[model samples]
Target chain A: MQKSYLMAPGPTPVPEQVALRMAAPAIHHRTPQFSRLFRETHEGLKYLLQTENDVLMLASSGSGAMEGAVVNAMSSSEKAIVINGGKFGERWGKICEAYGLEVLWLNYPWGAPADPAQVEELLLQHENVGAVFVQACDTASTVAHPVACLGKLVQKHPRTLLVVDGITAVGAADIAMDRDGIDMLLVGSQKALMLPPGLACVGVSTKAWEKISQSDMPRFYFDFQKERKALAKDTTAYTPAASLITGLHEVLAMIRQEGLAHLHKRTELLARAARAGLQALGLELLAPAAPAASCSGARLPESLDGKALVRYLRDTMGVTVAGGQDHLEGKIIRINHMGYVDSFDIVTALAALEMALHRFGQPVKLGQGVAAAQEILLERYPS
Target chain B: MQKSYLMAPGPTPVPEQVALRMAAPAIHHRTPQFSRLFRETHEGLKYLLQTENDVLMLASSGSGAMEGAVVNAMSSSEKAIVINGGKFGERWGKICEAYGLEVLWLNYPWGAPADPAQVEELLLQHENVGAVFVQACDTASTVAHPVACLGKLVQKHPRTLLVVDGITAVGAADIAMDRDGIDMLLVGSQKALMLPPGLACVGVSTKAWEKISQSDMPRFYFDFQKERKALAKDTTAYTPAASLITGLHEVLAMIRQEGLAHLHKRTELLARAARAGLQALGLELLAPAAPAASCSGARLPESLDGKALVRYLRDTMGVTVAGGQDHLEGKIIRINHMGYVDSFDIVTALAALEMALHRFGQPVKLGQGVAAAQEILLERYPS
Candidate 1:
């Protein structure tokens, strides 16, 4: 019998304990039992986000929260500076345009991070800028932007807010929302939270609330102001994904036990090991300059079919990794390093990659990448 | 040791097998395995909705789907007729008003159903009427509107489509979308679907699609057209709620095994027994005119503290039933009869309610409600 290993960036393997917790009987949302769990989960979210701001939990995927951030924080009269470095970055521009906001796009290569200096120059040029939208880590490109740097630049502009989609970065990386001047920080449950893809938590600063109050954008289900009012009473404006929230409570407890510093350190180490393993296999890094701690992308050999390789690894070998999207499709493979993953998980991924490559007619030495990954991962256990 | 019971209107108890299936390791959503599961789940949704139309699964609560139905079906150039019978019905008007659509509200009492003749009159009077929104079963009031009758009336008006919020009705009651000429039918996973919150399924008729094609309402996360395109390829426009979808696959299979007619009959029987039980305890029915099969609501005695009684049942007696919402708050109690609920569950709920009322000085006879409920529930067990 073959075993399956989930090594994707966003829908990483959920911890068994957390999964079981979510699997428990469903509870009524209006009861005090739910309110207690919600309150605890909200506090856990704040700790995970490294912010004292109000973190509102939503019932949709992360994109819904991204849309809420736009409609809540800005009006059609203002301009939105969107850093389009990858698919997720481009989504910010699309969402802005969809909401009737004029978007000034700063286009960057797929594997490249957004330059904070360029963003600052755009902010200085556009006087009516309401917000600058960027991804702390874009899962599509596996690139981590200079969110803290961009946060610093936008905080100086009193009317402008910095909204960062930390879907792939929040629990894995150490970007402090309040300390970094992030007006709105978004987190998806699936990625570093080690849960499913339903709950989206957004940490909103007081400055962001001020903007939200003034913005009369059309919204109902994802209404931040209404949710805020409900949060004061320890409830959500609408029906929450109660099971996911329960899972979140358990996961946040796990994160707290591990501590943010240790979690970030472990994640960075895994990312480093993944990068080293990929490099050892003679594969070029997709985001070598600023690789995200959540996952790592690497270019396959020009002759090899990366799409076929990924499918083969998944279907034949039972090792699930992600291939590239858009322009990079059929040319790259991405291996995750975040959430519920450990040193051996990285080793298993590298080993699977090596075997898949060899099977695909590439002259690859078996165990070569694993050896390199082990060298970096060994630092976790100082013996 | 105390045993807990979940007897709420929504978020009913999940089947043990379904919960265990969902608790399995998370799978990568972009893979072929997930695509197969998604395709099967989509087909299951169409079967459950009793329609051949495209049933789109969304990652939000039922309200989000209601908003999508409003924004996708009508533009600002047209007027919408909203049946404000309960809290959910009022939400239709709110969503319409939020999106700048002119809403013609047909206000009814909290526990009353919308009149189809009234809706027909509005359609006849309004030249540019786009759609009429009503609920098949409004959980708040436990009222089932005459959806099929309204469908026949709305179908006569080509420009006016019928949108039914079947959140509590789709799997529990008989709603033939295609046969009834319903343009849009929405379902929430937490209700009759026997899954947790986070997934909302919408079945759209060809008429609704024609309207959606012409509508220019701004939307991003809940974009129906974009989702339709992705659904054609066995995927979603954005990242799906993967775990919930996986659970849906199992739940739909269970629904298929228990034929639709059988399921509907069972739900109706349970609802009738619940009403009988409450009546036996000398409580008035909240929606005697048109009680929904998904749940049953009953008014508490004026002298009894309904809120305190409900809290006591939940906290002290380990039973969870929902208190009323808005004006009905602390005056009524709603017991669910949908999803995985059976005869014993009904007996347990009524018994607990009886004991709670007695404890609150209502002089309720212990097991009096249970005896009444069992008499009606006895039809299921014929020798």
Candidate 2:
């Protein structure tokens, strides 16, 4: 019998208790019980987002919330700056263009960290830019963007709102939304929240709400104003995804119990271990400039089909890891260490990678990667 | 100690097995394991939607899918017919208006059904109408529109695509999308899919795809064409709610084992029982023309506050039900019987309502509503 290990970037493993909460009977959205639950979830999200703003909960995917930020923050004819470094960054430009906004795209090479100095130059060029759309960490490239520096820089310009898509960054990193002067910080539930997808939380600053108040973009279901009004009453404007919220409450409690600093450190250690393991196996890091603490992307070894390696890990060993996307497809593989994951998960992924590579006709030591990961983990976890 | 009973219109109780599956480690989205799971989910949705057309999965709430149908099927300078009967029906107009479509509104009473003949007249009057936006069942009023009749009526207009927001109807009722010529049938996972509220599935007809191809409306995340192409390879266009999809596999398995006819009959029987129980308590049915089998909305009896009644039931007895929206607030209460629920749930809700009424100085005979519901349930489910 083969045991399964899931190490995907977004839909990471959910805690056992959290999953049990999701299975519990759903409460009515309009009832007092749900209202109380909703309030707790709202407050918990604020804590998770590290913001004083009333984070609005949406029954949508991360992309929907991303779209909400664009439409709510700027009108159709306004100008915006988009940092297009990877797949997710390109998404910002796409959402902006879809809404008829004039997007000034700042192209950065994939697997390369975004340059804050270049962003400063563009912001200076476009004085009337309504918002600056960016990803805190481009998940596809596994590169952590310099959001802290960018946020500090963007705060200098009062006219532009810094909207960060922290889908894979928020729970995995220590970039504080309020402290960093981020106008809008968006996250999906499936990532470090240790819950399933279907819920998105966006923390909006008072400054962003001011712009949202004046924006003329057409919106109804994703309207932030309606969400804010309902949020004050401890409910959602529409029916909130009840089970996911319940699960989120449990995950947030777990995060609280563990403490955010500890959580971030844990993820960082796991990421470091994975990186050490891949380097031990003679694999090149895909994003060496600044790797995300959530996932590690490594170039595929010679004579190994990236797709075949991933398939062998899943089918032969029952371990799931992600292959690269777009241009990097079939050339790289990503191992995730986010949400409900620990050092052992990294060991399993590395061990599976070694076995799969061996099966794919590569000459390598069986436990070299896992041994390298263990050495790093032992120093950090000390168990 | 209070035992909880979920009787909400949506976000219904999830089965234990399904919840456990959702809590399971999330597999990689692009892996063969997930591809097979996705393929099965796609097939299961087609079966649930009762449509031969391909069902596209989305990572948004029902409203997002509703918006997808609107923006993907019609351009900005188009005219559409909207049936405004209740909150959900009015949502059709809201979405259409948000996207800048000229909507010919057919206003019906909030609790009343749409007349097919009047719709025919509107179709004739507005020959240039490109689509008809409607809800199979308006959850706010618990009114199930005659979608089969409307679909047949709209089918006559070759240029007009029939878009039905079957958020609470597709799995609860027996309307066949292909058989009725529904161009677009949208449903949320939080309803009868027995899952959380983050995923939406839209089944598109060939005619709808034709209109979608010609639609010049700018779309990125909710793009149906991109979704179709990705679906052909057994994956979603964007990162799908992976855990929810995992839970969905379990829920669909349960539905298949029980059979659709049995599932529908069970919900119909539960709705009938709830209606009988409320009527026995001297409460008026909100939608007598055609009530949705998913929920039963009742006008509160004398000396009862709708909001207080719902709150008391939830806070005191741990039984959560819904209060009405808009003008119906504090006047109507809705008892849900959708998805992963049965006769016992209706009885529990009725008993709670009776107890709450007694506590609130209203003369309520204890067990009266429960007894009435038990009789109907026994007659239908004589095991």
Q: What is the TM-score of each predicted model, taking all chains together? A: 0.52, 0.52
Quality class of the docking in candidate 1, CAPRI style: incorrect
True contacts kept of 1: 0.00
Question: By summed lDDT, which 10 consecutive residues of candidate 1 chain A come out lowest?
Answer: A374-383
What is the lDDT, from 0 to 100, of the residue A325 in candidate 2? 90
List candidate 1 stretches off by more than 4 Å.
Answer: B1-383
Best by lDDT: 1
Worst 10 residues of 2 chain B by lDDT: B374-383
Candidate 2 residue-wise lDDT, B287-309, digit = tens: 99899998999998755678877
For candidate 1, state the interface root-mean-square deviation in angstroms to 1 decimal.
Answer: 25.8
lDDT of all the models against the reference?
0.89, 0.84
**Each prediction's DockQ against the real complex:** 0.01, 0.01
Model 2 docking grade: incorrect
The C-alpha stretches of model 2 lying farther than 4 A from their native spots are A1-383
Error in Å for residue A115 of model 2: 87
